[model samples]
Target: MRILQPHTRPADEAAARRIQDELRARAEPFGPGPERVRTIAGVDVAYAGAAGAADDQLAAAIVVLDAFTLEVVDSAVAVGRAEFPYVPGLFAFRELPTVLDALERLDTVPDLVLCDGHGVAHPRRFGLACHLGVLTGLPTAGVGKTRLVGEHAEPGAAPGDGADLVHEGEVVGRVLRTQRGVKPVYVSAGHRIGLDAACRHVLATAPRYRLPETTRQADALCRQALREAGTESGSPALS
Candidate 1:
């Protein structure tokens, strides 16, 4: 059964705002987030041709991580031809169908979902992570490789240093220098998690490299799956 309503036509600012508000209101507070968070799933999508639209193609994959030691617990993959067109504020329509289907193939429910997208840091105050989190009613975080919607200074040449991702006088997310000088990931709470907790989780899980363990593993899985599926593109290029 689908948790969110099917998308309707007339995608506009008003419509976007309405959907965002509805999801945000429905989002629940944090619970026992995997006590040890033993399982973390990282999701990534590969696009073929134009994004969205039935003509386009897409592939999604998730790599479950064993949080304690940051190792791959399990992996799942799914692929489908696209059925929607690329839209700025309404990515859910373009990607959610295949993504949800892919997630359904997972062996276990992840303690937390780390998406290679966005969360509340959006013009409508909601992004892909926020949409998926509420739709799945699970805790999710957005890890963008670039600034989506905010202003901040580059952190020091030291890992763990970060600046606030502020927009319109409100701090939407954080520009985290997960690795010194390489690049920063835009960290934001998707749902059922606070900002502080969200950042901390990303940092903690990223014990070895820049991106969190799950994300890196999942990213690799996406590429491998796409290659095995004989597709040209791997995933959405955020960098």
Candidate 2:
């Protein structure tokens, strides 16, 4: 995996925000993404210390799955200290370095990448997913457990039902029901993908659960990696 490392690591909140502002213009939130995605990758991060701690031991995990069967095909994990301070809207700065490292370790180049965060539905219209996609040039979308910035009526009870998520008078994403009677997930185009296609992928991948298997697996893997790192370092287990 040849991952592009273009942006220099930002040293402060101002620099991080500047990077976001510069790269955000390159994000293609609506596009002709892969029509037949054979594999999908999910990425997530977990921390072993308290939030915003500079010394927080964190782990990032990337899990690739066969889109059709939803079986794990490839996976990787990277454990490291948080490089940047936690900022509410600039979370990518804290997790992206490790996430990219994990992604670079993967053998399979996924046709689509799903993130456990927001995409265009963000305060700056550039969330973790968008940042990753712009940097990797991969078709990506965000399957957020909660809304980052948007307002929408509840989707219907049936699976696949969705409603537009509007923010700042623009449609940024969708509130989609992946499972009947389950809380909807926020679906947004990260890059090289459209909102409709992103929602379809979410529904297809989340056949049985509220969240896509990609997200669930990656989330579990990152947490496990974080715990193991903490144990090896003689630190207390993460709560």
Candidate 3:
């Protein structure tokens, strides 16, 4: 896979914020994205040292899957040290470098990407999914296990039920129930996608689990990659 829009690494929190501010303008939060989606990719990162430590090892993984079958078609992993400090709302800076490396190693470029984090439902409306979508110029969305921003009522117990996730007087995402009676996941548009489409995709990809198959597979792969890199399991800093 090739990156359509490469970006520079931020030297500090200020620079990272500036980058987000600049790129945030390019994100298309309201969209009808990928009508005929055939493939989807899930991206995740795992840590192998104390959080915020410069020496902390990072493992980034991207797993492309058949949209209908949910079978992995291609996958890649990259292991490296964290390049920037861990700052709230700017976690993308800490993981994107290694994630890009892994993306470049992939043999397939997916029709859409699903990040294991927030997107427009972030403090700056530019979380990992938005950042990665803009940089790669790919249609992307986020399906986060935990809320990063916004407030919402609990969705219904049935799968596919959802509620608006509102922030600052605007609907930024959705609280979606992918599995019946399971905890809901946060779904948000990253780039070139809308919240409705994003939620639809998430539900489609997560037929049998609380989390999407893409996320679960990518998460497992990143952890395995970290272990193969000879590091003990460490808590993930972001996703």
Question: Top model by lDDT, which number?
Answer: 3
Ranking under lDDT, best-scoring first? 3, 2, 1
Q: Name the lDDT value of residue 230 in candidate 1.
A: 69
> How large is the C-alpha RMSD of every model relative to the true structure?
5.6, 2.9, 4.6
> What lDDT score belongs to each candidate, Candidate 1 first?
0.74, 0.89, 0.90
For model 3, the stretches where C-alpha displacement exceeds 4 angstroms are 231-239
**For residues 45-142, could you state the per-residue lDDT of candidate 2 as single tens digits?**
88886769766778999999999999999999999878888777888888888888898899889999999898999999999899999998898999
| Global lDDT of model 3 | 0.90
Name the Cα RMSD for model 3.
4.6
List candidate 2 segments past 4 Å from native.
233-239
Model 2: lowest-lDDT 10 consecutive positions: 2-11
Pitting candidate 1 against candidate 3, the one with the higher lDDT is 3
lDDT of 2: 0.89
Error of 1 at 27 (Å): 2.6
TM-score of each: 0.83, 0.94, 0.94
